[model samples]
Target: MEPAADMETASASTSTSASASASASASASASASASASATAAVGAMMDGRLLQENALSWPEVQEICKELEHLYRKDAQKDAARVRALARKRKEISAACQEKKNTAQQQLNQLLGNVREWEQQSNTAKARRDELAKKLQELEALKREMVAQLERVRVDEQSSKESLERLLDTYETARQEALKFQLEHRNEIDRAKHFMSLYAAVTGIKWDFSGDSIAGEIHIPRTQEIVPFEIDSTQSNDFETANALWAKIDAAFDALDNNDEL
Candidate 1:
């Protein structure tokens, strides 16, 4: 009985050990399968990284490198064209700015000339105004002088008129006196002629009157007037006195005529 029990116990133990060993081998196989799947996923990710990092295989990445190179070349050409355009635009702007500067300079010069001309014109105007002012002052002085002269002339004219009136009155009185003197002289001459006629008759002497002076000549009782004649003392005296009176009256008339002329 002891030997049979020991043999059964040993068999049971051996079966348990074989069962544990099989379970362990199944667990290790499952772990190894999961590890293999993880490795495959890591390899796919590595290939994507290689392509993204520009580490592609030669033949596979050839067309992609060519397309990238073409895009880079096109961008470089575009940048070069933009740079040239910017250079041309800069040149045109510089030229335009220079032209504008020259135009502004010319305009400034013109403005300066105009300002100078205006100043000259203003000076001339001021000079002209001063000259006119002086002329006006002179004219005012002349006007005042003319007015004073007019007043003086008016006063002189009034005085001259009064003097002329007095002179005219004196002249009228002188004319009346002259007329009276002429009438009296003629009366005296007639009376002397009558007296001479009486003397001639009484003395039996021939008497004759001749010329503007009315000279009287006496002759002795004559057979003819053409014969030589003689005047007596009385006749001579009467003739001389009459002649002298006539001469005096003539001189007075001559003086009056001279005064009228003046």
Candidate 2:
């Protein structure tokens, strides 16, 4: 019975050793598969990061996804559908992320474009304002010049008017003086005419005046003789002689008159 017990113990120990070895082999296999799955997950994470970092085109991203699907199918046959589905989900996630990034980039581009346009418009407005300011300055200068010129013209006109008025006053004075002289001269001439007519009618002699002297020739009545005589009224000291000569003429004229009456 002891020998049988020893054999039974040996068989039990052998079965236990076989079971321990099989268990160790299965655990190692499982560990390797877990490590491979972990490595593949890490690789997929790195590939996803790479895809995210690079600005790849859509076709390039699609080709990379197909390659990852093929690799996943070869690595995990039993979980092929799940791996394919995960790859498809990753592709969709990448596409969504890429689309979101593209939308953000487009929005940034539009904002930049708007800013540029606004800057351009601001520059244009500034230029227009500067041009208007320049024109206003020129207009102000022109107005000042015009005002100055008008003042000068006014001054010139005032000066000319004053001069013309002075000339008119001078001409008026000259004309008045000329008219007074003419009137005095005409009165002198009329007095001289009246004296000459009185002398001729009263003395019965044709007389002519030379300055202040009188000269005439007279015919004696009933005689064929004429007497010529001259008198100088300008000689004041010879007035007595002039009176004697006039008395003699009167006597001769009286004798002639008596003879004519007889």
Candidate 3:
């Protein structure tokens, strides 16, 4: 009876080990499939983004979407051009500032080396106090000049950094404009949503605001729709702009051919 019980226990252990191994194998296979799917999606994501960008120009892409977005991302392409120009200028200024810093450091190192050498000389001629004083005065003058130059360079660096930040802000706004262009040229829903988003962004209106309604911090005009009624007489610049954009949207849709898809 003892021998039979031992055999049964061994069989049970074998079965458990086999089951554990099978589970591990299945998990590994699933993990591999997921990784492959993710890799495939990642590989095509950039291409899809490009296509989306291209789809913005009148519902059909004519040029390379990447280049088009880079060149004309914002109104009149002015902001895009400014970003490129400012980026180059920032690089140049940064390089010049770095070079100035490096040169100042080198000059300081050389002066210190000279001071050490002078100290060695003064020790050899302990009776020559006047000569040592003259050398010390000269070293102090060099140190003062180097410090002034370094201070000027640091101030310039800081100013350039601020300008770069401003330029970056403009560039980001322009980039968002380009993204909107892509959405505007997409299907009908996206095209309409783009206008709604624009209205919200420009007017700071997050919720529904009819004419004569107050939305959080925004005071809206009385209207049954998002746009103000008879916007021609509306004193609000935001409504005027929204109405203009909405007009263009309507015209574009009206001009679409019967067989044309978004």
Candidate 4:
């Protein structure tokens, strides 16, 4: 009985030692598993926090947005510059067109002025031609009047020449008839001279006969002074012969007075 109790007591001590060793190994495994789970939970919490920061308030996103804004501003500035250049080019083209139009207008005005000057010159030439034509007509009329007057003067000169010739012919005929009548009456004149001589003896006067004339010497009854007298009878009328005879007697009396005074 004593041996059996001692064995049983040894067995009991071994079993307890085994049980304690197993329990210690299990406790170590549980602790290791718990540590792995805690590490996993912490890793998940950190990943969630990182996702929230990226969505709401990350510095890299803010920097990216600022860079995009800068690019947009640069593009806008380039567009504005292009627009300004286009506007400046359009303004230059319009200014060139306006200057060209002004030059064309000036040329048209000069052409119109030249045409007006030419028309004025033509009008002046026409008026001068009209005046020259009028002067020619007046000269022709005056020449015709002068020609008519010359023709009338020629006709009057011809008539006067004919009348003068007729008057000369009549004068020549009258002179010839007077000379013939004096020759035909020569005998009658001699008989008259003889009777005159007989009367002169009684009247105390001497008589002498010449061609168409008589000459005599007479004695004055109161003083016995002798006087010479002459008479011309070549005219056709008695009044002409009587006036010539009386003029001769008056001349003889004047000679007698002059002799008495001497």
Candidate 5:
């Protein structure tokens, strides 16, 4: 009996130990299952948080992230090419602008030269004009002087002509007076000669009484007249008459000579 009891007690103890061991194992399994479930839940929450933060569904996020990476690489490559192209364009524009500025400067210099040349020509033209004006003035003055001299000469010529005309008139008057004086002198000489001839005829020398009586009568008698007997001195009468006639002739000659002298 003792052996059987001991055996039973051992059996009981073994059974109890086995049951406690089974219970502990079961609690451990439950704790392990709870931990696994918590771990699963935490993993699901992390996945949801990651999906919310990325703002995409799992498959869409994966594709979008891959495409974004590819686009970024492409954009970087395009930016590099664009930068190179812009640099090249800038260089070309700079060179073109510099060339344009150089051309403009050259044109400005040429224009300045042209302006200077034009100014010089203008000055020369002005000087020539001034000289021409001076020469014209001098010519005008000379012309005026010549005109004045001509006028003076004309006046003098007119005065000389008037003086010559006056002298000619005076000469003509003197000549006319001389001619009148000569004519008067000739007339006086002719008158004296006629008087001398009449006196000589009146004083005849040989006086015949019959001829004388007949000559003195208004009507001459055709027959010869007889001498008067009372005429005692006929010869003395004739001599006296002849002497008076000679004296009258001499007196007449002297009168003619005196008239010629005067």
Candidate 6:
């Protein structure tokens, strides 16, 4: 049993190795067949004629030789032309790229300059705004002060006008009172003057007592003598009457002198 098992294992291992070897041989054979077929087709193409000679004969061998030489020359010329064209295109593309890069760089520089100029203008505008605001504030404060001063002046003017009106009223009242007092005393002054005139007239005449019978004869004095004489009636009655009349006359004279002086 151990021998049979060993024999079977060995058989299986031999079968696997043989299968791998067979696959490799088949692959090599396929490659060789493909190579041979390609070579046969090439030989057939090489044997063909691309153009005709002077005669109707095929001239396959000679035509093939001539065509091969023409194809080789044509291929070399085309290769040289393609190399020149490629070189020209490369130069053009490089130049175009360089121009684009220069234009982009110039545009970037201009944009940066413009941005800086804009920032400077903004700063100037801000400064101007601040200055204007300060000026406006000052103007507002001045206006408020002016208004306050105007109010104060108006109040002072009103007070002065009121005081002037009161003074005028007081003066008018004093004048009216003085006029009323003068009117009330005018009639009394006129009556006193009339009585004085009558008394002076009666006294100026000479006495007529001789017509009436009295126990004693009465003597008459001259006007000049009686003018300076005193009556010999009762002492109190005669003295009092004469003194009262003199006082009234003196007062009237004094009032007239005062009026003249004024």
Runs with alpha carbons beyond 4 Å of true place in candidate 2: 1-91, 188-262
Clashing pairs in 4: none
lDDT tens digits, residue span 181-245, model 6: 77997788788877746655543423334443211212222313222223333445756756754
- The candidate with the higher TM-score, 3 or 5, is 5
Top TM-score prediction, candidate number: 5
Residue 33 CA error for candidate 5 (Å)? Answer: 57
> Which residue pairs in candidate 2 collide?
none
Question: What would the TM-scores of all predictions be?
Answer: 0.39, 0.39, 0.24, 0.37, 0.45, 0.39
Q: Give residue 240's error in model 4 in angstroms.
A: 20
lDDT by residue (tens digit), candidate 3, 147-188: 999999999999999999999999999999989976787787
lDDT of 2 by residue, 114-208 (tens): 88999999999999999999999999999999999999999999999999999999999999998998797988879888986776555555555
List, in order, the clash count of every candidate structure: 0, 0, 5, 0, 0, 0
Candidate lDDT (C-alpha), each: 0.63, 0.70, 0.59, 0.65, 0.61, 0.60
Instruction: For candidate 6, report its TM-score.
Output: 0.39
lDDT of 3: 0.59
> Considering lDDT, which of the candidate structures 4 and 6 is the better prediction for this target?
4
Which should have the higher lDDT, number 1 or number 4? 4
Q: Give Cα distance to truth, residue 179, candidate 5, Å.
A: 5.4
Model 6 shows how many backbone clashes? 0
RMSD to true structure for each model, in Å: 36.8, 27.7, 66.4, 41.9, 41.9, 29.0
lDDT of 5 by residue, 40-147 (tens): 765575578677766657786566566656655665575566556555655655565565556556666777888899999999999999999999999999999999
After best superposition, candidate 4 residue 39: deviation in angstroms?
61
lDDT of 1 by residue, 30-62 (tens): 655655565565557556858697676787556
lDDT for 249 in candidate 3 is 39
lDDT-wise, the better of 2 and 4 is 2
